[model samples]
Target: MKICAIRAFTPLTAALGLTLLLLSFGPASSSTGWLLAQDEAPMRGDKKVLTIDDYAKWRSVGQTSISPDGRWVTYAYSRREVDDSLFIKEIDGGDPAVVVRGSNPEFSKDSRWVAYYINPPEQEDGGGRGMREAGTMPTDLHA
Candidate 1:
């Protein structure tokens, strides 16, 4: 009688353990699905796709520094495949001027002057070789 009782209990215990294991590792519940559905909904209706021309005309602005007296702002701007230009403008309002052709513009402590680095133009070997073969190298450092 005791053996019969033990045998019947064993199969029940095995089924309960398997069910618990599956529940722990199975896919997430319906609440997770509802949250994901909310996130997938669009926030706006009037968005337009961007085109290549829009990208071509875009100017990327880089590091900016303000003058010590708060009178001038200096920044670097560049377009794709173009040399970077350092621009300086008056805070009150005026056309920005190209101070130099370089990157990483900095303002002096007294805001009297701006400084930056300019890479020297590449040199050709005069052998009518392509860029990969000519190996033009930067020759000078400018500020």
Candidate 2:
């Protein structure tokens, strides 16, 4: 049990350590998680596969919208921009072409209609004249 007797590691041990270190750093996926690894490691064992609904985009930066059937999802690919307002990706195929570009997008309750706004929010504002010709503001000061 002499602490001083523990000499340096052998070359074989050093090689084994290096190999393991490289392997762990290369690619690995947890058995239960939404993240995917770069490698094709069958680490899931007997666990079931997952879909887009199981994960959420950046909580603060982006928003998530799930379809009624939970088979599809739409989220902001990047910042809500004029060219790419929102993107709709299937849980299975989930191709990029399924994206909807415009101001505000709307999905039907039954996951039927997927409409993208044609105009901006500012333009859509109902800021027209009132029903009757109203006068100045309520000038009756706090009584």
Q: Which candidate is the best by lDDT?
A: 1
Instruction: Estimate, for each residue in 1-143, the C-alpha lDDT of model 2 and write its tens digit.
Output: 11122146865445433432332231223222222323332337665444443333211113344445544444443322223345454544423333333323445566655545432233235563223221111111121
**Whole-model lDDT for model 2 versus the true structure?**
0.37
TM values, all candidates: 0.47, 0.33
Residue 70, candidate 1: alpha-carbon lDDT? 59
The per-residue C-alpha lDDT of model 2 at residue 3 equals 15
Deviation from native of the Cα of residue 138 in model 2, angstroms: 48
What lDDT score belongs to each candidate, Candidate 1 first? 0.45, 0.37
Tens-digit lDDT string for candidate 1 (1-143): 01112245464446433432332231322112111111222345664344554445345455565555556665666555455666666655555666445555556666666566664433465444223211111111121
Q: Show pairs that collide, candidate 2.
A: 90-94
Residue-level error in angstroms, candidate 2, position 142: 63
Model 2 alpha-carbon drift over 4 Å, by segment: 1-61, 79-83, 98-101, 118-143
